[model samples]
Target: MHEQREFIPLDKEQTPMDTPKRTIWIQALKVAFPHTIPILAGFTFLGIAYGIFMHSLGFHAMYPFIISMVVFAGSMEFITANLLLGAFNPVYAFFLTIMVNARHLFYGISLLDTYKGIGKKKWYMIFGLCDESFAINQSIDVPKNVDKGLVMFFVTILNQIYWVVGATIGGVFGYLITFNTEGLEFVMTALFVVIFIEQWMKEDRHVSSLVGIAASVVCLLLFGKDTFIIPAMIAILGILTLARKPLEKGRVSVQ
Candidate 1:
């Protein structure tokens, strides 16, 4: 009986309440992507090498793909490929994995404050906290408006995606490829060196850096390459813990 008004659908009339959440993700991805490009290159190369290694061992493509996603521990996964071919000893495997990944304990401790209050993201962040992710996330400076948690989340996921994709490609097509991969394995090591140099240049104080170098050299000489990592990690943690107060004081004074 009254004048007909143009009808608009309720679903299309207004934006969803979660628009801010979507915006946060988009913004975080934008910030996170550039930082991870180097890792993308490194991870892809190493992951393909790993997949090819597994394929050479006569493992199925699914093995490397699944291991890359589930294990996500770069060095340990390589060791695991060898372990799978040998005698089955859960105790040996367990201890060896712990020894290989013992550095993560230090990584976790250093990140406690940075990762605090990140809510559920903390879970996946921890899960995907590889060496490269740790370096980037620990040093990155996020924009004030964007969420740091989301930035870290994207970095972790993006790095993993690179690794997974590379591994899948190598696994699926490794047999068809015949080019030499002789020196490709060193790509990740080169990446680590680059990251270390970048961090060294960024900081004014070299105390921590010097301590790490000295400890590593000492441990490597004493324990040799195959067994040095755990000892070096232990030495670094002990020295850093004891010197925390002095380090903080020095940092404050410098500022």
Candidate 2:
């Protein structure tokens, strides 16, 4: 018995992982309902714009409906109508999609620790990942054992539903009712502004948005609209990186 006595290294201690113990499906439904209102209304407008565009190209309303469900991406679904109109090369479309949404790869990294638990839910959670959902999720630090994956999944699904419904409405009603759909697309940008304002109200740092706007303005002038977005993103990232020391050293005021 004395000979058998031994000590395991602290690093080598084997802790049993906890299996997730919540009804994610139910949790998803409840958490999604409140946020779903703004999402659904906003998406309805955007989806209508996309559907109108598609239907005007001689396709039926059903086209946008089908694509919205499967693609489940707002920006991607909007541009995808062109794929059906012109040369529908599967290979190019596949590659184009990867190139267009390549930013998603980086988005996933931010979620690594947040979604690490929930053995089975992790997979579905990843699939539901999108820009709006990421924005909402990343804003909060979940407490221990919270099923964020479930929340994220529901947010994503709700956002998609909005898009699909909007698109279907636009595609079907587009021809019958001809009106100015112009400038309505700006509503998406407005949604971002609203979120930014909300976040700013809760926090003290408006510096990030300031830096982003300044850099974007300069980049827009130098690079032109088509090439500005990527450069603006790079500039914003660089500014944040360069400002880290000032932020940490108390040279900057967050409040």
Candidate 3:
């Protein structure tokens, strides 16, 4: 008879039959979760505010819940809430929504290389690419062993979940609440500023950052708050595209 071997128990984190896919996801989530903490705090409060605003507008809690799930466009959802209260105007709504979200076009282009080869996850990545998600994913430097795509996928999904959960809670309980949300909208702007600073600290050069600032200021001065977003995004995109080669070279040299 052959010698008997002793049985050994495997930990939850380990499995003999586990595929690389599962392992990568575990590693990715570990890396991704920390980066999304800021977004979680910001989205939670803002999403609640959005839910409360909708409830105050005579819409049921389901309205915010479903809209947050479907639209996932924070600013546009608020505008859509108002639109629903008025006479139907698909044409106007279409143009207005496009104008409001025009910056996403630039966002998509910027993420093309990052999101490529991500397989089916690319669809959800594109869908869930909100402001906070974009900011975090764009600025993050994933570890060599982790899967960048999975990290981004988790970041996108977690942010969406935070928004959806918050909106749902607010919708379900907003009537029982009575608090001031006057300045809550600024949370997103504050988050962006923080992310910008983080990115600035991580980078060797500030050319791109400075370009973004100058473009925004000039556009805001010329087009005003109501109309500057699209122009600013366009300016940023054009400038960055033209400077892509220099930026790549600088990055390589720094590395």
> What TM-score should be assigned to candidate 3?
0.83
Candidate 2 Cα misplacement greater than 4 A, ranges: 1-28, 88-95, 140-146, 177-186, 204-206, 248-255
Residues 169-193, candidate 1, lDDT per residue (tens digit)? 8788867777776777676677677
Per-prediction TM-score: 0.85, 0.72, 0.83
Model 3: number of backbone collisions:
0
**lDDT of predicted model 3:** 0.84
lDDT of candidate 2 over 194-236, digit per residue (tens): 7777777876656776897899899999999656767777787
What do the candidate models score in CA lDDT, each in turn? Answer: 0.84, 0.69, 0.84
lDDT (tens digit, per residue) of candidate 3 on 1-255: 223443222222333455565676788899999988877887888788888788888889999999999999998999999899999999999999999999888789778766766667779989998888898888889986666777899999999999999898777786776776677767778889988899899888999899999999999999998999989988988998899998887676574
Cα misplacement distance, residue 88 of candidate 1 (Å): 1.8
Which of 2 and 3 is ahead in lDDT? 3
**Count of clashes in candidate 1:** 0
